[model samples]
Target: MPAADLPLLIEAVRMAGHVATGFVGKSAKRWDKPDGAGPVTEADLAVNDLLHKVLRQARPDYGWLSEETEDSSIRLGHDRVFIVDPIDGTRSFTEGADTWAHAIAVAEFGQVTSAVVYLPMRDLLYTAARGKGAYLNGVPIQTSAVTDFADATILAAKPTMAAKMWRSGVCPVFKPAYRPSLAYRLGLVAQAQFDGMLTLRPSWEWDIAAGALIVAEAGGAISNQRGASLRFNSADPRLDGVVAGGGLIHAALLDALA
Candidate 1:
């Protein structure tokens, strides 16, 4: 099932990437979303519309959930759903940075089965299917084997390192890194480019759904902030946070955060 969906997601995400690249540095009209939900651009909506039309047309029975689309309880009734973030880093895209990505996934019974994250400017395509492993540009990928917390290089916003968040009351020492797109951070972890990634604030499902499956298929561990398994297509469409990395580092990070 995942194998069938994998190619579909890859094609959809690649097409979405093409649409997004057209707006890069071209001054696509942008504005802040109401309630400070971050920025949105004409490119975002265009890409969203294209993806919605293409994917839904191909899988009429599948439910739909996208960052650009209004929420609908209709998805909860379907056994399979498509979760998408047409542009995972609006700020990066608007600022003419190349780190933004198109994240897409198919979820069945709340578990993601197939996923893809495409960064057009970077020419990076990350894909994965549950039980089939992860890949980067068609080559297999895996999480870093680093187990020592202090030696790990982690991707996260500076706020995640705040002393109060960890049980130690002082941030555990690890090299810190940052990426504007949540999906790309997870992809980097899947590629073993970083030891792990996390965020303390609530995360949107579209931003992390595809990456979650990629990381898992790459032999990494991922979960909500409290170390619970991550589920997709929730009615609220948000998660407490995300913690993902190689197995030993993932466990150690969870232990330290606890």
Candidate 2:
């Protein structure tokens, strides 16, 4: 069942990515969400519409949760839901950066079963299916084996450099790289291009669902910053930050945050 959904998920994300790529470097109408959330664009809606049409038509039984769509209580009844971020890095996309991506995932009984994150501008495709491992353009991937938290390279914002975010009052003690898309950053960890990734702010499920599974499939571990387990398709699809990395690195980071 997972294998069957994998191709469909990949195709839908690729299609969304293709649609989003058309808005890159071009003038796109944009606006801010109510209450100072973040920017939104016509591109986001366009991609969301396409994904909603293609993916849902392919599997009508799956519920939907998207960054650009209205949330509904009906989704709670489904055992499987499609968590999507039509264009994850809208800032990157609108600013003509190729780091943005379309993130898609199918969560079954609160766990991701199939996932895909495709950067249309960059032509990078990341995919994962439960028990099948993770892949980048068909090649299997894995996270770095770094055990010492200080030795691990992480993806995070400049503010996280401060030591206050950790329970120990000391940061991970490693320099972190910045990526515009959260999904892409997690994909990098899964590919071992980075040892780990984290965020100190709450995150939307669509932004991390696919990436979380990708990391898990690649022999990495992902959870809330406090190292709690993550479950999807809930009444509220928001997470209190995230911490993901190769096994030992994950453990060490979790301890620091704890």
Candidate 3:
């Protein structure tokens, strides 16, 4: 709500972004999540520590939730919470790729109000403020106007990690997308660089919070695969699905994936 805090949030993310990039291609140690789909690295912990300290200093009243930290009931007491993913694409980063970066968001009363996704490798920052509009770097951004589904360029969340869904009637083939970071992937749609993205793999609040606002403000739509609204800070943090598309091809994209 405070206009001055926007720049501070951006700065914190940018600084964190720099630290994350420092570990790239360094053979950082990685471990798998409980589900074992991908890995988490030490780089994630380093950035998570930096983010918590910086954000708390900037806004002590805000609560915290991040992929690297243990979930606590403390966040429910605060009016605002900072949701973060220290490294959204650890697999990519560990593989000597440039798709990883720090993702952060600020949600008030469970409603995402502002966000920042810093793509350190590309030096592209995607940000948003509810009602104010979305931006890439300092310039404003919007989703694509492509009204036709056939011509739209799509990004798949599990693009290369699709072997897990072969039995669900939905083929589990991860499509190769240029933006490896989930936050940045949604940003592409908001910037009109891509038409949409589909992912059967569940995503967390921090993964898409800023990107949701980015696409929404950029004249697009974001929702569960069944075309439902999103609610943050739930007991179960996993979102069953997500379809982020420019306003036009949204419905059709869902149908095609079905």
Score residue 79 of candidate 1 by CA lDDT.
Answer: 98
Model 3: weakest 10-residue lDDT segment is: 166-175
In TM-score terms, candidate 3 sits at 0.88
- Model-by-model lDDT, in order? 0.93, 0.89, 0.78
TM-score to native of every candidate shown: 0.98, 0.97, 0.88
Ranking by lDDT: 1, 2, 3
Query: In terms of TM-score, which candidate is strongest?
Result: 1
Q: Locate the minimum summed-lDDT window of 10 residues in model 1.
A: 17-26
Candidate 1 global lDDT = 0.93
Model 2 C-alpha lDDT per residue in residues 1-258, reported as the tens digit of each score: 788999999878777777777774448999999998789999999989999999889999999999999999999999899999988888887788889888999999999999999987777899999999999999999999987756778898887667787788777678689998999999999999999888978899999999999999999999998778988988999998988989888887778773
Clashes of each: 0, 0, 5
Task: Please identify model 1 stretches exceeding 4 Å from their true place.
Answer: none
Whichever of 2 and 3 has more lDDT, that candidate is 2
* Prediction 3 global C-alpha lDDT: 0.78
Would you give me the overall lDDT of model 2? 0.89
